[model samples]
Target: MRARLLDATLELLVERGFAGTSTTLVSERAGVSRGAQLHHFPTKNALVVAAVEHLTERRGAELSAAFEELGAEPVATAADRRTRLRAVVEMLGDHFASPVFTAALELWVAARTDEALLAAVAPLEQRVGRETHRLTVAALGADESRPGVRELVQATLDLVRGLALASTITDDSARRRRILREWADVLDRELGKELTA
Candidate 1:
């Protein structure tokens, strides 16, 4: 029941943004009664904030699962390393372009003007950002203790996020693919230099 409400809230958030989504709408979408929805989440802010947190956890798990499925074979050659790195970059880009990101963006936009929502969202965003950075480092098999590697990983995340934002305005698929590919090459070279130095 709670899961259903949260899922519906996420769908509505992506479809209608925070201002348009209401508890009534969420109840109807979830096929759960208003009473039940209220019983679980007493306010719209509670419902939406919980939904974001739930979606973030789910998305993070999905990313970890996807990364695991990418195979753990040793990179025996430079070509193999490049291929693996490119796959990671592509995966990260796809993640940022997903509906979860769209839904989160809606909350972020709304939170900018709503002090209460901002209070709720700020810590959540920090936690999500840190988790994402950690996951990216793990996915890339990066040692952040090395100089410049941490900043490079952060830049990769920022790049993907910016690409995701651009995609919200229009079909940025072709350009995104090109940019990700170029960025992947840059990562490979930079990380390779760090590894060998």
Candidate 2:
């Protein structure tokens, strides 16, 4: 029942943004009764926030699973490291371009003017951002302690996020792929240099 409501909320958020999403609509979409919806989430803020958090958790788990599938074998050569790096970049790009990102973007836009939503979203964004950084670093086997390595990792995230944002307006898949491919090459060289140095 809770899952249904949260799923409906995420769909509505992506399709209609925060303003178009309401508790009543969510109940109807979820095929849940008004009383039941209210029982679980008393307010629109509560519902939307919970839905976003649920989606983020689910997406994070999926990404983590995908990362695990990349294998635990130690990188034996620079070419091997580059291959893993490219795979991680592609994964991050796909993640940022997913429905979860679109739904979260809607909340971020709405939260800018809505103080109550901002209060809830600000902390949530912080946690999500931190976790994403951590995951990306781990996925790439990046050592942040090296000079400029941390900033490079952060820049990779920012780049993918910008690509994702550009995709919101139209089909930017071709261009996004090109950019990611090029950026992955740059990261391979730069990170390789840093590691060897």
Candidate 3:
């Protein structure tokens, strides 16, 4: 029941944004009573925060699996590392374009003015950001210890997220793919230079 409500909340958040997603809609979609949802979440902010956190955790685990898969592959040389870095960029682009990211984006927008929601989301957002950077650095075999390397990796995430936002409203999949590919090549050159230096 809890899981169903969370799932319904994420679906509503992605489809409706923060303004459109209501407890009534969530209850109806989840096939649960409004009373039941209130019992579980208590408030709209609570529900939205919980839902975003749920999606983030689920997506984060999938990302971890992707990083593990990268490790299991035979990356024996600098050339192989460059190839893997490109794959990681591709994977990050896919993740940013997912519904989970859309849902989280909704929360982030709403959190700007809503102090309660901001308080609820800030720590979770920090943790998510940290884990994402850590996993990306690991998967790319990038030297985070190097000056500017971590910031460059973080810049990669920001770039993909902006692309994801653009793709959400436009018929830009082909263009988005092109941009990601080009950016991957750029990351490989810049980051690889730093890591090997």
lDDT of each: 0.89, 0.88, 0.85
Better of 2 and 3 by lDDT: 2
Pick the winner on TM-score between candidates 1 and 3.
1
Position 133, candidate 3: lDDT: 88
Cα-lDDT of candidate 1? 0.89
**Backbone clashes counted, model 1:** 0
| C-alpha root-mean-square deviation, each candidate | 1.3, 1.4, 1.7
Model 1 Cα shift for residue 173 (angstroms): 1.4
Model 3 per-residue lDDT tens digits across residues 1-197? 99999999989988999999998999999999999999998988788888877977877887788677767575778788677877888888888888888888888999999998888778888998899988887777778788888888899989988989987787677888888889888887887687557
lDDT of 2 by residue, 85-131 (tens): 88889888988998889988998998899898788788878888898
lDDT of 2 at 197: 82
CA deviation > 4 Å runs, candidate 2: none
The alpha-carbon lDDT assigned to residue 111 of candidate 1 equals: 90
Counted clashes in each candidate structure? 0, 0, 0
Q: List the residue pairs that clash in candidate 2.
A: none
